[model samples]
Target: MPDKYEAELPDEVHELLAAADKDREIRLTRAATAENLKFLELVRSKVKDVPLFWAVTLLSHPELGQAASSTSDKEVFKYLTDVELVQDAHDPREYEIVFHFKENPYFTNTELRKKYSLPNGTKPAPADGTITDEMRAFEAIDLEPSSMTIEWKADNDLIAKHPRKLNSEDDEIIDGDIGSFFHFFTEKSDIMSLGGTIIDVLAEPLEFFANDPSGFDSDFDEEDEEDEGSIDLGDDDDEDEPQRKKQKKERCCHP
Candidate 1:
């Protein structure tokens, strides 16, 4: 893992530590490093601190949120860890959480229309009521539609609130890019909950990449070229028509 603080720490800071073998500065530097490492380890340990089952349950039946209201942090942690569903974090105790919802292909449009009270004879329903068969199937598989944009602030606050050696001010700003990517992948899974907030933070970059024009520009250009080539083929056929008529006339005369 990249050193969490490497980017923030000045280059001279390490040199200062190396040069001062017997000085108080060296002792302070060593102590700081130890403290930071320990803090990160603690964060890693908590990556699985949230319960995946509870998250899924609550997401599928949001009504169950009341039942899980009493769930302790340690219980949630154990559940997540038991299932080997841990978030990758810069520190051991800090975990990025991901919640995913994926579409199920098995369910047909007719089934969804019947199940969700969709308007009959689909001329395409209104945007608010638009639930495709695939979307309904996804819901059946425990994936829920979320209008919630991934909230990074919540994750940042959660990390900051955790007891650690690093000062709140010194806490590394969790990169939004990592959080977004994690969320993008997780959103495809059958889990959901408030814990998804963590995953959303990780998936920000992924969402950005998906929408970014730079990545798709080349493919778009290739497709355009292929379309142009097809148009040229149509022109070629038109050009060949007169020659085909001439050959037919000659053959008729000879016969």
Candidate 2:
């Protein structure tokens, strides 16, 4: 267990926690690795940035605007790739998000990707010789802001209004205190604090989920499966919530 929060977590978060715990063992078995890799390929092909963008959108709300600095993003990302957990002041939901992102693999620039080419293909070889199919490499995720561009879903229903009046004399001077969400993205684009934002906003929906998780158990499995890939929150489970919580074998990521 990676220290449960003092606050009760959402069921989906619980499901995620349970899975993360078992992943350490699952990664050691070659059979598990092959199955999980299939699932990962399925997800990487079908769900590219669903988690990343959804996480950011959840944070962009007035109450959940991210405060973590870019350095925090960098450090947290290091922890994420290493499958370790660290205390985060900016987001209480750090434990949950980090475990979820554990599958994000090591990626590189054009030069490095070129250096490790796989046999005849342009694709890079495994990150290192030790890299095996059992490794949880969610390499499809492009965390670098410069390498990725996002198209926000139309803002019609997505807008969040400010809860506090920016009445200070220099309120206009403060960048974050300004009036628009699009502007915030534009300003933060250069700094690469986008990762921090992804980490921070997770709390918003999670807090919402901690209460309901909007029925996440159906999509996630309690028993480690050979072909499981990733979290698909929309799916529904047959077991009632209380019973699902009792299972210890629940796995987190396919990898």
Clashing pairs in 2: 10-210, 19-251, 19-252, 59-201, 209-213, 218-236, 218-237, 222-250
- Candidate 1: where is the Cα deviation over 4 Å? 1-22, 51-255
C-alpha local distance difference test of each model: 0.26, 0.29
Residue 104, candidate 1: C-alpha displacement in angstroms: 17
lDDT for model 2, please: 0.29
Candidate 2 per-residue C-alpha lDDT over 1-255 given as tens digits, one digit per residue, 9 for 90 to 100:
767657788999997776675444434443533443354345335534333322333322323222211222222222121111232222111121122333222222111000111123223324343433333332313222222222322432111322212436533434443233222322313232323433333323323222212222323332244333222222133221111112222212211
Q: Which whole-number lDDT from 0 to 100 does residue 126 have in model 2? A: 40
Q: What TM-score would you give candidate 2 relative to the actual structure?
A: 0.22
Top-TM-score structure, candidate number? 2
